[model samples]
Target: MTREPTVAEQSHPNYVKVWGVLVALLAVSVVGPMFEIKLVTLVTAFGVAILKAYLVARNFMHLHIERRYVTYLLVGMVALMLLLFAGVAPDVMKHEGHQWKNEAAQKVVRDAAPAAKVH
Candidate 1:
């Protein structure tokens, strides 16, 4: 047997969703300018983007209509994505050390070039 919708769920309040979207957008706008570092700004941007996507999915796509298993799948997928990011970060840090070494070597070469010209 199917169940009926509750009075709260009966009418789709589009304006409420519109306000959510607007508030999320406004939050991004407000937060993005507050950070100066590139990585921080990027993380903040993606956080707000995820918020907006969640609002869209919940209200527009009616993800609320989906079953519990689907919500579990979404949660698992988000966890996997976080794991992927964490896995890649170590490699980036390792490569960044090598980049710093190469930059240091180049600086030494640059400083020596003028000395060589004098000799």
Candidate 2:
């Protein structure tokens, strides 16, 4: 015999609507670069990506209904990631070593800076 859903389960979000929103966001992200505008593409792709992640985590993972500690843990993990990236970035970004220099990497950074500033 099939069991009936609890009140909590019945009160859960409309999954179809959530999925439709995700699909629409995906389409926007995919089509964003076609406009060839750097700012628009960046906003659409990254903004949509962050929103999509939130929707999946909040809806599918049910993170919003979880205890406060789970939210703290998630924030802590993200903070740690940012810290780790900051720690590693300087060394990775340094194109000059003790003896050798990474001309290609430096060139790319130099080339991209002006383009980035223009947009």
How would you encode candidate 2's per-residue C-alpha lDDT over 1-119 as one tens digit per residue? 89865434734898899999999999999999899899999989998899999999888777787767988999999999999999989778799989888899999998999899998
Candidate 1 lDDT, 1-119, residue by residue in tens: 89876533754757676776768786875688587777767766776677777777776656677666877898899999999999987765443363555556566777899999998
Stretches off by above 4 angstroms in model 1 are: 1-11, 15-20, 23-31, 34-44, 96-119
List per-candidate RMSD values in Å: 8.7, 5.9
Tell me how many clashing residue pairs each candidate has. Answer: 0, 0
Instruction: Score residue 85 of candidate 2 by CA lDDT.
Output: 96
Best by lDDT: 2
Q: Each model's C-alpha lDDT?
A: 0.72, 0.88
